[model samples]
Target chain A: MVRYKAIIAYDGTNFNGFQRQSTGRTVQEEVEKTITKMANQRVEIHGSGRTDAGVHALGQVIHFDFPYERPLEKMRFGLDTQTPDDVAVKSVEIVADDFHSRYLVKEKIYEFRVDIGKPRSPFRRFYASYFPYAVDVAKIERALPDFLGTHDFTSFCATGSSVEDKTRTIYEANVTVNEAGDELVFTFRGDGFLYKMIRIMVGTLLKIGNDRMPADSIPAIIAGKDRNLAGPTAHPEGLYLKEVRY
Target chain B: MVRYKAIIAYDGTNFNGFQRQSTGRTVQEEVEKTITKMANQRVEIHGSGRTDAGVHALGQVIHFDFPYERPLEKMRFGLDTQTPDDVAVKSVEIVADDFHSRYLVKEKIYEFRVDIGKPRSPFRRFYASYFPYAVDVAKIERALPDFLGTHDFTSFCATGSSVEDKTRTIYEANVTVNEAGDELVFTFRGDGFLYKMIRIMVGTLLKIGNDRMPADSIPAIIAGKDRNLAGPTAHPEGLYLKEVRY
Candidate 1:
């Protein structure tokens, strides 16, 4: 048996998320469908993580095992022909048998896009989150560093998550604002993230940046370890799994 | 009755065209449907020109008459709230009775996007034309000047167009290549354009740039004034009605 690892990019607007479910479409389902058509047999793919519904991805990683081998280029093109235009297998390479996509410990970088000040664009509606209110970049920048280092992110995690251990390490966090363009891109690089952790963190940052929450609310929220202590979760459409580094 | 002019933007992926049609959904149909709901009576809009199926627009101009006065912003928001996310009323203003959208003499700017030497993007498939070939930007730039000045563009116009006079003044033409990004954006500004003129021009220019046709072939093709003399018409998804200069 041969294992193949692939980097995938998806729009995620029409998808129910990256995981397979009983109903609705998912990115993993589309990939499996394409690979099955190529291999002429049922196949399953393992994704590194699960993004929520309406979330996009630039470099989500996945691995699958095939009974026989095929040229990577042929496999790539074959997958492209079968899947819809919104999903693409960006790159593929053969990997060791032990290289499991999810079990391999690695850092994941995520980007969240926000369109601010300017009117929302019809073309960008499916990709960017539109916020017409004012955003104070200085406040957001100041609060970003609070997310660095290891912490039990219980307050940032969504309620009802099956995840029991909430401790995770955030290697870096950044907030960049294109003032002229009225856009904001927040990036988070961590060893791992809990369910809806990044979205909750962004929402809390925005609340503080907009002066709805106290300037020093982040440390308190993290220490509180209560879901209700954090601000509302940001929309999923703006979140993207940007990269996975092993 | 009061006259209002609107600058609109649409993705055009789901639309049949900018004009009302009997079968498929159209940008005009959506706009009129929303306004009809607002005004409580039948109303029609006059657009600057018709965009073919699968064509997008950034600043398409349209004018219509209403039975009563309304704030421009309110009307814009109301139309947005009623229509699908793909179409947006970018701006609105009350215009004089003499202001006719289609009859006003002005220049129009059109843009064509080409994804050169890169894999097709999942998110941009509905907007950009993917040409997986190396492009010679210098060759395209050299051939562009030959297209400037007043000329009969019958060779560039799509066949079966009803317009008899194909003579149009080319105000400016520019070619820009994003070297790092492997993308090309071609802009054409003229008093007006023939049916698919910009697209045909782009295709012919690409032909020359890719060494399929001679660099000096443009002048001869324009002089020929026959539809058979020009290169193939480019796809509609890459064409955008960028702006209208009043």
Candidate 2:
């Protein structure tokens, strides 16, 4: 048996998410179905993690075992042909037999974009969130540093999370503006995340940026360990899983 | 009465292009309906041009005459609130009554994105075209200069074009890549274009980039005044009308 690790990218707009489901379309189901047709055997794709519907991903990692040894290029093209236009296998490489995408990943990066202008950009609607209210960039920037490093992110996670451990190590968290364009991108890289953690963090940050919360209150929110203490979670459309590093 | 010209943006994935159609959902129809509701008056929007179904736009220009003389911000926000999330009114401002989005525009810019990789990116599935084969960047670059300046772009347009003037001035035409990402964006700013002109140009350029067409043939394709001279028109998903300059 040969183990192959594939770098995946997908527009989750039309999908139910990454995992296989009994009904509705899914990224994993599509990939596995395509691979099954090509390999003449049922193949299961293990993804690094799951993203909600309407979210997106680039460099999302997945691993699967194929009985026959195929060239990386061939596997890539074969998978590409079988997948829908919105989901792509960006790269495929041979890996050690025991390699697993979720267990081996070192960090994951996600970007959430906000269009902070009065004029809504229709073209960017699917890729970014639009917030017409005034935002205090300085306040959000000041509060972002508090989210960096290991912390109990219970307040930032969605309620009913199955995660037993809330102490995730956030390698970095920051906000940057695309000066050429009037847009802001929030980037987060972390060892692991709870369900809807990034979206909620963005919501909390937006509240802080808009002066709804004090910049220095981030630690308190984390310490409270209460999801209700955080602001409402942002919409799913603007979030994108940019990459996963191993 | 006030004449307003707005820069618009929209995700065309769910639209049947920019024009108002009776049977299908259209960007123009959506915006027009929104304006009619806001102004309590029938409004007709004159767009710079119509885009095919599934073609996106970042800076599409449209002009409409409104009987109510409201603040630009109010009008912009009103229209934004009324329109669906897929289409957005980016900016609104007063313009000369003589100004027409189609006639008075100085230039229009459009971009086509191609993903040259083994696995297709799912996140950008609605925004880019996939090409699994390796591209010859040098050959594609060499052919760019020939497309600049004034030329009869008949061959690069669809056969059903009804426009009397096939001649258009291309101010800038080039293929540049994102420095950090595995994506290629082809931008073209021109005085005007025939129907399917940009898509045909992209198709031909893609062929040249893939070594299907010789670099020297671009000029001949333009001069031939025959649509058959160019390659197949590219998919609409990868195209975007980025901006229209007054």
Candidate 3:
């Protein structure tokens, strides 16, 4: 058997989530079923992590083992064509047998897009979160530096998370507007992220930008380690798993 | 009664078309239904023209008569809130009693987008038509000039169109790649267009770009006035009714 590593992209609007479950459609189930059908046997695939429903991905990593050897190009083409239109296998390559998609030291980048236009555009309703209220971009910019270092992100995590250690190192955090001037894009790069941590951070930053919360509250929010002190979780539609680097 | 002119935009992915019909859901039906509900009476709206199913619009104009006079802002807000998420009313204004949405139009601008990238992107499936074949943009640019000025375009018009004249003046025709360099955007500004005319023109231009047809065949195709002489009609997902001017 040969181990293969692949990078994939998916539009998560119709999916329940990245993980397979007993009910509802999922990216994992769709991919595994397609690969299994091609292999003529049951095959399991492993993802770097699970992304919630309505969250898109530009470069998610996965690995699986195949019973027979085939050209990497043929495997990529076969996987891309057999799977549904929403999921695409971008690239595939042979990998070491010890390579694990879920483990090994790595970094991740995520992006959140918000439409700041006055009247919500119908074309962008599914791809971006609508925020018509007034917001000061400078305020959000000033507060982003506080999130650039290693810290316990307990206050930014959702309640359902069971992980005991909430500490993670953020390598980069920044916000920028597209050329159209109608969207605010927030990007975060980190060694790891807790459940819904990026969304909570975006929600808090939006509040600060809108003046609903103080601009200098990030340090205190992290030190407080209270989930309630942070802002509400942002909508999942605007979130994207941009890249995973190993 | 007062006449209200409104600019509307719709995603068109879920709608049957812009015109009202007895069958599937349409943008006109959704807007008229929402406005009638607000007025508490039966109402009808007139559109600039009909757009086929799966064709989006950014500036579709419509006019309707209302029994009561309400603030334009309030009416716009009401229509926007009541209509389905796929439709949005961009602006509303009171027009003269004799103003008509269809007859008074002086110009129209349409845009067609083609994704020339490899391995079609999942995020753009609904918004753009993917063409993975090799094509030369300069060949397309050379052929675009022939489409300008007044000409008989029966060869470019789809067969379902009943319009007899088939003659239209083209004020502007151009093609440009987006900043990402992955999409080719074709823009055509003209007095009017017949059924699927823009799509047919794009299809023909793509053939010329791909070297499947002579780059200089547009003039002969126009003179032939035979629909079979033109290339296949492009996909409707890439076509958009950009604007209608009075």
List RMSD in Å for every model shown: 2.0, 2.7, 1.2
Q: What is the TM-score of chain A in candidate 1?
A: 0.97
Which 10 residues in a row give candidate 2 chain B its minimum summed lDDT? B116-125
Off by over 4 Å in 1: A178-180
Tens-digit lDDT string for candidate 1 (B115-234): 773347777788877777767888999899998999999999999999989999998999897655767899999999999899999999988988899888999999998988888888
Q: Give a tens-digit lDDT track for model 2, residues A74-175.
A: 888878777887887778999999899999888999999998865766656667887778888899999999999999998988888888889999989988
- What tens digits encode model 3's per-residue C-alpha lDDT throughout B12-72? 8999999988999998888989989888999999999999899999999999999989998
When candidate 3 is compared with the true two-chain complex, its DockQ is 0.77
Candidate 2 vs 3: which has more lDDT = 3
Q: What is the TM-score of chain B in candidate 3?
A: 0.98
Highest lDDT model number: 3
Top DockQ hit: 3
Clashing residue pairs, backbone N/CA/C < 3 A, model 1? none
* Model 3, span A1-246: residue lDDT tens: 889999999999999989998988999999999999999999999999999999999988999999988998899999998999999899999999999888964899999999897568888897888887898999999999999999999999998799999999999999999887889999999998999999999999999999999999999999999999999899999999999988
* RMSD from true fold, candidate 2: 2.7
TM-score of chain A of 3: 0.98
